[model samples]
Target: MRSRAGLVAVCGAMLAAAVALPLGGTAYAADTAGATDAARTAAADTPSALVLTLSPGESAQTVGVERAVTLTCTPSPGGSHPAPQEACAELSAADGDLAALPAQPQSFCAMIYAPVVVTVQGAWQGERVDYARSFPNECVMRAQGGPLYAF
Candidate 1:
């Protein structure tokens, strides 16, 4: 009888511990919530940074072969991007997901197979981003990416 009672108490204690644990990380809600809030606040305060690179691999452009620029959305969208305001707005509208940016429907481009590769490297809203894509031409890139790639 004594052993059975001890076993039941131990099982109850274990169940209580499991219930109190937050995702099995911190042992309590208060601690986990505080840490999560601190991390979110830090991320928000830090200026979001991203580097945009465009390479005219097979494009017929003559003046600039390769171009790159730094973009910061937070702390007022300060960067070397040509259209920083528009770019930042578009990015925010898309929730930092570059691939989700909507493409313009009315925009038309030539069928030339001039491949222009573009890359975005860095962090967006504290989330690491490494995006790369090859557009058939610069026009398609602009039509699809909007002011974000207009730089």
Candidate 2:
């Protein structure tokens, strides 16, 4: 009877250890996964390229169609030279008239036109201005202009 009781006690301890070990490993894995997810979220929020904000003062006067606006690209997180960042602005009826009127002198704002591209030369750090030109056809204009702004 005594030997049987001792055997039962030993078996119970072995089972408990086996279960506890696996649970501890699972907890460690969960912690690692959580850390990885947080890191990814942080990276996504940071801007990888330089961005330009369009203001009413920057737009140029035009007639018949809208004008193409380009941002002066600066150094992204890692860049060396200044590059032209092209974006598009949609001109409303009011905007069109503003563009046409020589006396009134209409102004348009700037906005992001496309996803930023990275280059080997990268971007420069400083305040630079790029002019936005008017184009007749958007598709053709974008293709030919490479990067362009619309207003």
Candidate 3:
């Protein structure tokens, strides 16, 4: 009878350990939620100065500016897929102009399952300027696929 009781207790302990082990580990919920909130706040704070809408057939845009500006791109969902290629136009500020032109344009390519981000920086009027944007071609393609719809 004592041996049987001991066996039962051992089994119960094993069962308890199995059930409690996984639950005791730290949960990622809090961390994930905080990260998500931060990302949203940053996105809201940094509004894109220029929006370039590219058709499925269209792949690029040339932005004309007098002063140099920093540009950043982050695709929705994530940057596992390719993004469209982008080219920056040369800066042409008037003489004695305080603004600076971007030295290079941000570029990326669109992919089927992967998304990507591009960032560029420069000076304007001797003051530091920054821009941020994102593109998610893969998500768009998954939602809508076609020559005109392909991301």
Q: Write the per-residue lDDT of candidate 2 for residues 1-151, one digit (tens) a residue.
A: 9999999999999999988988799788988898978875654443333232222222333122222222332222222212333221111112222222222123332444432221111122221223243333333333333322222
Model 1 spans with C-alpha error above 4 angstroms: 1-42, 58-65
Q: Which ten residues in a row have the lowest lDDT in candidate 1?
A: 56-65
Ranking by lDDT: 1, 3, 2
Clashes of 3: 26
Local distance difference test, candidate 3: 0.36
Candidate 1 lDDT tens digits, 1-151: 9999999999999999888665766456666788999987887776788999888774324335388999998878878998888998999889788999989779999998877878898998789998887798999999999999898
Clashes of 1: 0
Task: Assess each prediction's global lDDT (C-alpha) against the native.
Answer: 0.85, 0.35, 0.36
lDDT of 2 at 33: 97
Which TM-score value belongs to model 3? 0.20
RMSD of each: 7.5, 18.1, 17.9
